[model samples]
Target: MINISYDIKEYRKQLFDIVNDGNVIVELGCHVGNTTKLILDKFDNVKIIAIDNSPEAVGKMEKLADDYSNLTFISGDVRRHEILLEAFRLTQSCDILSVDLGGGYHPDTVFKVFYIWSSTFKPVHSIIRNKGLVDFCNSAVVGCEDFKSHEGHLESYIDEGIPPQIKEFELWTPSLREK
Candidate 1:
């Protein structure tokens, strides 16, 4: 159970709840290994392949990974195609894909990478950050069911079912999922 005082604790708890034993999780932006530590403490038999661009962040994750043998930290920008490809090569597939890149200058870039990651790996679940990105993905990412964490809370979106492949038409136009 995530009992931390951080506002995102409940969100992390919700994410952890979906995780099962022996599951492989790919985390896009693991800053300081806070969430990674939580997941390690909670899941005993899970493998977490996490990536971060900053050396400082990767160092923190490295320290955390030393304690848990199940963690593998990659030091590189996850937004880069080469890095993402490397991540895919390392993990092969994932049960849950957790992305929280802290809303960079181009949110679209994050979505684009997510689209690529989702299409290639086809994760069973994805819990992404921010309202606008969540809104964008709901329509753009195929096989996405409109899921609200709680009533009137619009900061994130969680898809529990298996993801579908990207469509040709969605690549050309922007669409929002209608409630």
Candidate 2:
């Protein structure tokens, strides 16, 4: 049995509830198939496409794939828009897209990368053409003034001594879309 953390369980519930029956789900930065397993269990009919850049992570995902028939694991960088576009092309418009990328410190660089990658593919907006859902977790504004006070931690965003860029896109959230 998989040992799911409370935080991850909540995220899984959110994702599972949003996806329609038999819809497609794309999980970016799937590490070790933990969340992927949860998704598979929650939505048995849904097709899951999990992507991770690390070879080790991909190997782990492949091992888990043996038990789950609905899952397809791919090794690639989600930051590369072309790669993600190609992956999405293989399936129908996604009903749910979960982003768990930028797992490192150095919020400035990570935020910039996130913006670049997000702009390349508007997953939240694009996937929900006919009303879908996108769940973006563990994301923070890299060079924001507020983040500067944040301490450097493994999962927390680390603010380097860099000011925010003028052209930065404000981080997108479910609430933001409503208002």
Candidate 3:
């Protein structure tokens, strides 16, 4: 969901290892079921609670969920707490949380969603795709705009107990869900 990706397949492939470790996955932004298919195809027993704001996207998810009884797709704006609560009503806990709001998601909004979801579910794994946060984190240039704008919050998150992890591939974010 980063701002740019030349090879979508390679960008999508980076998620293979991160999504490999969980059973109950809480996913945000199931656009056309690209990543959904990935998780479904990789594991037979995994249960996914997927959310999206677009009815079209949710419709696609519905079709994908046809063969998989384990998947629960909810059509709603994932940025809303109500939506989170609704999803939570279906499952008390989560094992993994994967978020891909696509390139249009603002960095701050993406981080806020991540923080809330991580706090709520405390998943064993979490992945996010955002160009802003990624740019902020990886930039080494002193006073780099991204770093200056996002470093404080990033550090604060770590101080508050969510240490950030850098991915080998910039298009994807991979983090170990902390206890």
Q: Against the true structure, candidate 1 has what lDDT?
A: 0.63
- Cα lDDT of model 2 by residue, 79-168, tens digit: 554555556466634545555553342444344444343333233311111101121222333464443211111112222211234233
- Structural similarity to truth (TM-score) of each candidate: 0.68, 0.54, 0.70
Q: Which stretches of candidate 2 lie above 4 Å from their native place?
A: 1-9, 102-179
Write one digit per residue (lDDT tens) for candidate 3, span 1-179. Answer: 12222234544665565455447888887877888888798887788998888867867888888868888888887766568668767875676677788856788778767766665565665667777767776764556444321211232333243223422111111221231
The global Cα lDDT (0 to 1) of model 3 is 0.64
- Sort the candidates on lDDT, descending order: 3, 1, 2
lDDT agreement with native, every candidate:
0.63, 0.51, 0.64
What C-alpha lDDT, on a 0 to 100 scale, does residue 3 get in candidate 3? 24
Q: Which pairs clash (backbone N, Cα, C closer than 3 Å) in model 1?
A: none
Worst 10 residues of 1 by lDDT: 170-179
Best by TM-score: 3
Residue 104's lDDT in candidate 2: 40
Which TM-score value belongs to model 2? 0.54
For residues 1-179, could you state the per-residue lDDT of candidate 1 as single tens digits? 11111236555866777789898888877878888888888789999998888767866888888888999898887655567667766765688777767544256655655655654455777666544554555557556666543211122423222123433222211111121
